[model samples]
Target: MLDRGTTSDDDDPPLQKWLARRGKMSALSLAELESCKNYTFQLGRGPQRCSDVPSGLTNSATLLKAEKNSPTKEGLLASAFFASPGDGKGKVRFLTFLHQLGDKKAVVKWDTAVTRGMLYIQLPEDPLHECSRDSLVELLDVAEEFSSRAIVFFSKKRNDMKQLVRTFKFIGFDILPPSCDWIPTSQEYFFMSYEFG
Candidate 1:
């Protein structure tokens, strides 16, 4: 049997559950992409690192990760500096987890959901301090070990909960209107998970 697409039934559920915890979702909806300017205007009206950008999806194929411990910021998102699905809605899910003061810290959750015929590895978690160079190397190694797979990073910095909400809403997720307790700086909160890439 030819194994098509990224394989990781073990990791996706926990990741999905973690994402669900971060945001409130009720069914799926598609976005109404009115115009190019309009789309670009609301791309990322949230946190700014002065370097983060979106990386549009290209079949979810091979993804490249930036150097560890390096001050440089590049290749961070599928279409942005965060780890999220770029454009469209359909099956998109919003991760709206809130981070507590101390207990809520960043974590990594990577799994491959590749094309129907090929393989690709996606790091669907926070790239915080926990993800050391060695850990990332190990993750890449795991991907290489699979021969047909490529490991990718979904950084938390550019892909905070707020970004998720906005991105999801843009893609037509059943996101509730932004409230004070859930808006403004709420994106800065930590929605830490126990898992690591």
Candidate 2:
């Protein structure tokens, strides 16, 4: 766990800035951290499968399938998988978080091919609030380790877009242009990215 003591500096890391923005005086602690490539389907079809399973973002079909079957909403398990190119050649990475009681907390998907990682999904139950600031900072640190940039897409239908955008900006993510060739563009979603040194 990283320490968040009450200290001020001219060069505080983004995590410190975010923690200060949250206005919490108490130190934040993270739950146990875990990482793996294997994920057992919540529906329990069989043994744990590697993150390289077919249900990845390799193609439109697999991307849709992965979205349709995503377990992020259930909060049952923190699972992640990498989407490689169709030729089955690409780097893969994943991260998972477990609570002190051993319950799953969050899952983050990372893609190294583009040198940009996406926060594919997080726990629907606001794991960030439940787990506190350290967890989010830890995720960012992992993302920085994996790629030069990190991105997340937000649905236009969300009513809290203003607040969400503000919070993201406060933590160092920049709102990207409305159009992006890498993703299926629509009027429904906006993108944001955080650059790492």
Candidate 3:
């Protein structure tokens, strides 16, 4: 029989223990995002550069120009730049997970407002890759503590749309109706949201 440790620290709640056994998720600073060599998002067009702004995700001209020109003031000028309405009341954070060996596994751009939140996943180059379920759950757990709901948007034309939809639904997100007034109407994309009680 397996020996379950008896120490109080070892007796972490089921969710905490499960999360601890998987991997660590933490916020990534802007400098870290810029330094991450493995960061890439495969948009059907091709693998986009790390500095490229995710389509339909931001309207910040500063972020756009910063991402376009390398070694520019992107780090300084865009550090505090708010990209979405969500940023008006709160801050934007980049979260990532690293494996036991410190290899980056996933990255998420998170924007939080007083009551609303959003997530933008940076897809890996590997077509078969997906963020680990544990990591996503941990992210949701964190989001739940702050926002009443979390939202995600996906382009209809994405190659992984089917898989992404399934994954989000598996994690408790529901497809938002086309008439949902919380999000801006866009013909090119669909939205999903997870409401916390």
Candidate 4:
């Protein structure tokens, strides 16, 4: 298990905003909250079929299916898949998670493609809270949804990487060597993909 002492971080803009905004939430009830900051779904092949399948992105068809299946959802919609290299070769993986920002909700589709030397992992704006145990589980669910053979995470900032790695490790993910060069970054970013056992 990971040590979740406090949701406090100096480099986290969400945490910073959390500290600056809102009143005491001690009396706040999660029961009143209709949705979660991070919500997950299963699409395409799950981790169990990773070896027999591949990795890709969550397509519109799947999103439409989800919309039709459930009519009353308003939060980050995560669609995961296993995709082969953009060239029909190489390897790719996928998973998704959500971050609370405000009352506003949006659907973020990670239509990322891994190229010879580049991997595009696009996400929505920053989150509104620190990564907690619940959020970590959501992340794993998303990973398994993609049927990823292995999970990977990347962050420009070492601190963010440390925090992310801690959370993932607590949830049973291990660090793997980089398959490609990770660009040096001043801002924080995270990329994690898990392999199916």
Whose lDDT is greatest here?
3
Cα error, candidate 1, residue 71 (Å): 35
lDDT of 3 by residue, 12-89 (tens): 233232222221222444444333222212111223346567543211111211121222222111233323224432
Tens-digit lDDT string for candidate 1 (95-158): 1111112223543334433222222333445433443333334443332322332323233466
The TM-scores of all predictions, comma-separated, are 0.23, 0.43, 0.43, 0.35
lDDT of 1 at 52: 58
Poorest lDDT segment (10 consecutive residues) of candidate 4? 60-69
Residue 184 accuracy (lDDT) in model 4: 19
The candidate, 3 or 4, that scores higher on lDDT is 3
Query: In candidate 4, what are the lDDT values of residues 1-197, reduced to their tens digit?
Result: 22111212212232222212211222333332112122123223223335655324322112111111222221121222222324333332222333332233433333232222222334334431443444334443433323233334344445455666676677665554444233212234455544444
The CA root-mean-square deviation of candidate 2, after full C-alpha superposition on the true structure, stands at 16.6
Candidate 4: regions farther than 4 A off: 1-128, 131-133, 142-146, 179-193
What are the Cα lDDT values of the candidates?
0.28, 0.37, 0.41, 0.32
Residue-level error in angstroms, candidate 2, position 104 = 11
Q: Tens digit of lDDT per residue, candidate 2, span 39-73?
A: 22111112224645643221110011111132332
Query: Model 2 misses residue 14 by how many Å?
Result: 22
Q: For residue 141, what is the lDDT in candidate 1? A: 39
Q: Is candidate 1 or candidate 4 better by lDDT?
A: 4
- Residue 152 in model 4: lDDT: 43
